[model samples]
Target: MKNIIKTILLSVAVLGMSSCSEDKILDLKPVNNILSPDAFTTPTLIESYMNGVYNAAAIGQYNSTGANGGRGYVWGAAYVEQGECRGEDVVNMATFYDLTYSSTFDATSANNVYYWVDGYRLINRCNLMIEGTTDAVAKGIITKAAGDDYIGQCKFLRAITHLELLTYFARPYNDTPGATHAGIPYRVVGVNTQAEIDSETVKPRNTVADCYTKILADLNDAETLITTGNSTAFASRVVGRASKWAAIAFKTRLYLQKRDWANVIVEGNKLTGAFALTADPYAPFQNTTGRNTSNSESIFSIQHAATSNPGVNAALASMLKDRALVCISPIIWRDADWKTDDKRREEGKFIYTAAGIKYTNKYTDVTNRTDAAPVIRYAEVVLNMAEAQARLSNSAPALTLLNSVRNRSLANPFPTAGNPVGQAYTAASFATDADLVKAILKERRIEFLQEGRRWTDIHRLQKDPIASVATNGVPAKVASAATPPTAAFVLGNSFAITTPVAAIPYDDFRFLWPIPQIEMNTNPGLGQNPGWN
Candidate 1:
């Protein structure tokens, strides 16, 4: 096991290079060790090689600014999915932050750097593993089942990467717009044929139909491969890492984007039975049971192993350490020196002298450890079920589903001494499916905040005005320009934090990120998204 870990660490660490130029240093063992057909000559070798693919897809440099740069690399796609502006955009006057930036014609420099390289780098690793595994199996190294499982995990990873790209680069799946917009550059299987290599050549944008067809194909394939599989803590699982449920989840997600509510409901219900929410909703991240919890609620989760203690410092040190400047936000900033309980005039965290730091329940027990990152959780399944039900006009039961999650937040949504005022949810008298959806969407915002789903959900639910928060609705008014009191997260007294009622002010043009200028200059066929110049 130790040797397997070491063998793959070199390859996994190399995935951190996506942020840099193609000339970026190669951190993996020689492409020779990577490509050695002989190396995968054993079942162990093939299994070890599979590790490289998972790590590459899931982990990234902890120091990079956004979640895209590190272990929560999914954060990038989530951000784009919801049209989240970079945290920097809140204060950076020079940059235009919104869906307008996502437009291929007018993307910001930061947006371009994060989204493009992250997805492609993941895609490349997936391709390498897929191609390599086939050779190993052909040469009689791995059993048919072993090969099937590896391929399943690989396909699942690839499907997510492509869908993530599609949400940003292509139009949402609709019979109308999908056919017009360009889907991402699609490729599958071995790059053996001239046609295959040429397929990489600039083909004009795929119809939204074609883009979805490609994604569904990958996910369906993943469904077959992952259902009967099992993997260790660092690997995939049956109905686990991009497993049957995940494939279904993604399909539900895809159909939601496609605005196909009936199908979304069908797929989402299947996910519901996969994982039952635990009695204590926050137990998944409690320091004690966090790392090892496999309750029914978690349909799919990318498990992280600790190399160090699990304190916030260790849990998030890699990303927060060098981000002294980035941590100024109200979350877990590194150099903010904000050690107190003054909520109104607060910093990243409220230092509870007694309870310690105010941490997100998504991860607890950050006392002195590098806690594993849970990418997907049972709570999400509960949330997904509630949402799908609401979208399908099951309003009465939907609200019940919604309340199940809301009742669980640290700030219980029902309103209490802890959370003084519950997030409001109404419209029980709604006349149609659309009305119930509005309630469901709002419920999602309160449920998934900061977990990196807000922005993406906002993007997915854009058509409905109430579903997405407008960032620029009104400029925030700070108590004092120099020493602005905490406003967004604050609702407090003189000593308590008093957050401003911030709104999401979106610009039409920044919808799809501008294609990277570097890519455009090099890959002539790589046309930009709509609005970016």
Candidate 2:
């Protein structure tokens, strides 16, 4: 469940994940401000308007479950039918979690929708401001130089919104791509041509690839515009807003998705000295004093106010010190296999309870006060670099970086075993680079459990499958259609189709979301994505 605090996050960066009510504020704007429209002719008014757009981007539901139920119960029921750990192609995403879906919009989920709409809404506003300011500059209402800077900020805000939307609404740019797929409508300038749109709106969805290109263009444009100085992580120029480094960091992630391995190696190499890995990987998440521990490892994060969503997101006074929603399950316990030293998990998730049962304390606020929510940590760079090297057949040295991270998590140096073959440790048992990658996925899971990275990592790797807990399964109708039913059964009767892999392959048609049925009915031009019925 998400906490619905009415307070704004103490934000430095304009990564505006706030609880502020914009529609109310906008509706209640002073008549003179609306009437004078001339007020927005000045640089001060234009900048203030631009800042509001960032506020729109940050405010969204921290979590939203389905109409049927939240993950635990629905997942609990799902596991009973499928006998699988968890179907990663979760059915609720497009159906239940989509804020744009007609019935799902509410204040709880409104932030995400509002955040998105606000960005575009602001984009329209920016366009209006630019047009007006140009007219004003020509007539002496404002200066041309001031107007240019304001427009650049608008571009950055527009790009950031699109990027976030692309990540959420569309499939990963690297996989089941947006090229053939229809991305969210690309709205640049504000236009509510509803009547005209109803009759003549023929905007074809851009391919996911096209959306990525647009995102890159905006970021590139933002870099050129925002390249002055970004010292503070949360300054008005940097925090709550996109900065040059923040843009690059985001670019790096996009490139990684496209599997531009060379760029991954290059960009990752270039960032060599920027991030510092923690001796204890969990410290960045649990240490209150060391919340921004990843100031060394993390590139950027949309810092939240301790008041908005409270601990449900990241802030003080939010039972994060004492409460638990996002916690380690038996999945990690089973995955760790009792083989590796518990050093990482011990430091990362587990704390001895009064009865001595090892209870997870990672999300416990004060006891393991890791206030920082990492967006991109240095270890990811290290992992990405190693992955790049492995992909390049230079895996012999990849272990150096891998070992660098592994050693820190270990209680003591692992005594080398067996023999040595060239750079390959003879005693170590990874038959090939593929084996190493499998290991990397396993390591990533151990390190990033409950950090919102598991499902996405699967999108990128698409190679390995970890075992899911006694959870996750596909609908019987779907599973039988492909593999064919071994038997017939009633809907309520419980049955299981056990599989070794944790994540079941999504029925092929499920690769992308069905264009919402309403959209299909209303807009003949908008086509549905493949795999939907």
Candidate 3:
């Protein structure tokens, strides 16, 4: 196991490359000790390593992140399924209590170690690609333009992967905008040698500010080199690889997390002319025929193939549709103002089980988990702009942007074309900016449920969760009503249930997970997050 880890971590650059049917050049070990110099000298070899980086992306499943010898790195969809369970919008209905929601979960037992390892492991591969490309260009092994392209791809992945780590492990950037709060160590160089790995082992966390600075630098460099033309040039090769637009869309997320409202609007505006909302909002997820991006609402998404499934449990369908273990929160689902007409809440969406509990039918593919996982979407960018404008006190514009999303979903009626009436609101509907902002937030809750972003939205906003894990229940039909009935998870003795309200304080240490004990034990320099010790 140790030898395998060493090989995966240290020698990722020199892994053998061969073209596959999927256009991915895989790491086939034809020879025992290939030299990095020989492997990374050509465009084909460098691209092979880049494909490996893409291959390392997790599909939001327990065992999918390649930690503890897990299988296959496909796309960012893995993050959504795994992340949705952490937020308040969804409930894990099975006996399994995900560590993300467990108050008593300890540092030693902290889950998602795969998240940390998979991220850095992939970043290390990117570092190798970046370093190898630079050296290849300097030695005239590859063209300067080729080197730049490779570097841009590496940087884009590096930035987003680092940001993912920060989202899960480190304190939120807004917790302390300055370099005071500890963020994950900003690792740029590949751990090529044993000494370099040892040095990295002892390095402390960088400040949140430092990490963000590094992220922005990488994004800026990537955007400068990876223009739309460059992406168009490579269109015939791969459709979903990160491009200039992906970088811009990611900045909207990054800026929102940091509370940089102005920049959020600035970055979001760049996307307005490029992509339009899906004619049918569900078409992006409903595309079962193939992995084509035509008529996609996503600015960037991880394309999954039917032949290469990310397991039932790891797939989004398992949470709600196929396995049907997790369900929408009864309380939130029954909310009076959750946009009844919105296409997201069609009748079959929440199927009734024999237990009188309703499970989501959002994930339709039980046979093959080949659905495209969204990383960034056109609607999210609109919301980002709306939120930024609201924060900047541009109320009229914010409401207009917010209403645009409301209107889009209204226009994209599903299951018999406008069976349920859609709701729309204007600036006159809200008395103040806060009201409008809260309305937008609520819209997101309804819009993005089970997409794995609710938890991040709650934490980044520093809002207290409305309920906790102990407060569990499922929504049931109440006499052919439009919405489902809400029940509570009862305690002992009386055999009675009460609607429970468990609050996770905004400052709760559980908001930031402890660094897994395995990581701490293996590396002497690694430190645990506060309140975990």
If ranked by lDDT, best first, what sequence of candidates would result? 3, 1, 2
Per-candidate RMSD, Å: 8.2, 10.8, 7.6
Model 2 C-alpha lDDT per residue in residues 127-233, reported as the tens digit of each score: 45455555667877556655555555566656655654454345655456335555766655433223323332345667778877887787676656664334533
TM-score of each: 0.70, 0.63, 0.81
Candidate 1's C-alpha runs over 4 A off are 1-33, 61-111, 174-179, 189-204, 227-240, 291-293, 306-361, 364-369, 409-435, 465-484, 487-507
- Tell me the spans in candidate 3 whose CA falls farther than 4 Å from its real position: 1-38, 59-75, 177-179, 227-239, 288-292, 348-362, 411-422, 463-501
Taking the candidates one at a time, how many backbone clashes does each contain? 57, 30, 2
* Candidate that scores best on lDDT: 3
Residue pairs in candidate 3 whose N, alpha carbon or C atoms collide under 3 angstroms: 59-78, 60-78
Tens-place lDDT per residue, model 3, 98-181, is: 455434467654245545655666777678778878888898978888778778877988898788778767767766636478
Window of ten residues with lowest summed lDDT in model 1: 2-11
In Å, residue 10's CA in model 1 sits off its true spot by 21
If both were scored by TM-score, which would come out higher, candidate 1 or candidate 3?
3
Higher-scoring candidate on lDDT, 2 or 3: 3
